[model samples]
Target: MDGTIAATSKTDARGKQKDKSPRLRKRSGFVFILPWFIGFLCFTAGPMLFSLVMSFMNWDYMQNMTFVGFANYVKAFTQDPFFFPSIRRTLHFTAFAVPIQVVLGILIANLFNKKLKGKKVFRALVYLPCVLSGAIYGLVWNNMLNTDFGVFNYFIQALGGEKVEWLADPKITIWALIMTAIWAAGMPMILFLGAMQNIPDHYYEAAEIDGAGGFRQFFSITLPMITPTILFVIILQLISSFTVMAQVLALTGGGPAKATYLYSLLVYENAFKYMKMGYASALSWIMFLIVMGITIVLFLSSRKWVYYEEKGGNI
Candidate 1:
């Protein structure tokens, strides 16, 4: 009976150990991610919350915070002169740039995927802009787009055309930025190449066996397979285009006029340059809502286009 009682106690201890093991694992995982969690809360979430609060207030860095209750937001929509133009310019850039980049990426990826000589070198050459310093690229392009003695205008002159004001004219400045963006379209192409490589060879083989030509195969098989990647690239480009400021700052500094003054640059100017923190916060929130809304629409519409193999091609 004493031996039996000792066995029962041992079994109970074993069961207790099993219970504590899961708790210990949970604690260990929390401890492992504690640094990231703390950093997120302190840096990302904390600042976002603070910014949200500040959006409703009238506080500069050196002043008392007075809660104005949507005054900043209302002012941004109704009174601010830059608000609509900035949004319109940013959206205009996005509308043009994203589609061009997407198509260019697809074409480059297709070219890179083909079994051609010196393909690796071509890939690296195309992707160089993506990895190279953006500031350097901006400086180089800034000079290249100069009205006189610039490579682009020199070529145009060689063709007996006029030297265009690529950067100076407000009418042409936005297009110049668009051209710069397209020049760096190689990253998305590389991404699409990755997506393209993942597509099963059997699909292509079957299409060929069915007498489908190159265009037919691409339209029916390749494109369908890469729709998910296309969606991802579009979303990424959308966000990037909307928040583009540093490159614009380096190149045009919002232009010969405010023609290239994007929405994000407007926010930065208000926050840091003009010291209108509250107003800037309102602009930031508006930009966030715009992006979030567009992203949501994309996602909701993605069910029709974004093919997920894991879902067995079902929405």
Candidate 2:
């Protein structure tokens, strides 16, 4: 009986030690993550907290900060007419750019997914615009769309039409910018292509066997299967479009009565050029809130559209 009790106690101790081993492993993992945690606190979290604090105060780099307590926000919403206009312009850009990119991405991805010779070269060529710098792309497009001595205008002239000041005319400038933005749809197209390739061949084969036509199969199977990736791309594009500064800066510089004055441009002008650091911080926080709110709304709405292969199985 004494020997059995001793063995049982030893087994219990061994079991406890096994449990303690995982705890030790967890502690070591945390130790390994400590540097990254510290860096995040110093770089990301610290700057974000500093910005929040600064936003509530009146501070220029040259002077001491004085707490004004939401006055900057009030001014942004009420007194600054530029703020609302910037928001409207940003939303307009996002609304146009996101859907256009997503639909075009899907179209291009579907086309590329087909078996063809020189497919690899075609893919690379299509993706080239995405790899090029945004500023360079904008400059190139701006030259192309120029009223005089431009290829587009030359074509228009050949077709018996007058030159259009694509960038200078507020009515038509947004369309010109949209054309520039669409060239970078190559990235999202690549993403959609990747998602498309991951889809099993069995689904298509099964659909074919069921006598489903090409369009029907695409609508019923291909689209639903790809919905999650599409949703992700749309959200990313929307966020990116909101902060699109480089293209507008290089191409139009918010041209023709500030029609293209994005919120980021306004923030840049305030913080750097005007030395309104507090006001800029306030603007940044408001923009952050707007993005977060939109993201939340998308997430909530995605339940109706986004598909998971594991759950309910359809879009």
lDDT of each: 0.88, 0.86
Candidate 1 local lDDT, 1-315, one digit each (tens): 456555545555686756655654454446656679999999999999999999999988788999999999999889999999999999999999999999999988987887889988998899888875767777888999999878999999999999999999999999999999997688889899999989899999999999999899888988898999999999999998889877788888897789999999899999999998988998899999999999999999999988887657534
Model 1 reaches what TM-score against the true structure?
A: 0.92
- Give the per-residue lDDT of model 2 (tens digit) for 258-287: 888889999999999999999999999999
Q: Each candidate: RMSD to true structure?
A: 6.3, 7.1
Clash count for candidate 1 is 0
What clash pairs does model 2 have? Answer: none
How far in Å is the alpha carbon of 283 misplaced in model 1?
0.6
Residue-level lDDT for 266 in candidate 1 = 93
Q: By summed lDDT, which 10 consecutive residues of candidate 2 come out lowest?
A: 20-29
Candidate 1: stretches off by over 4 Å: 1-20, 310-315
Candidate 2: lDDT over CA atoms?
Answer: 0.86
**Per-prediction TM-score:** 0.92, 0.89
Per lDDT, the best of the predicted structures is 1
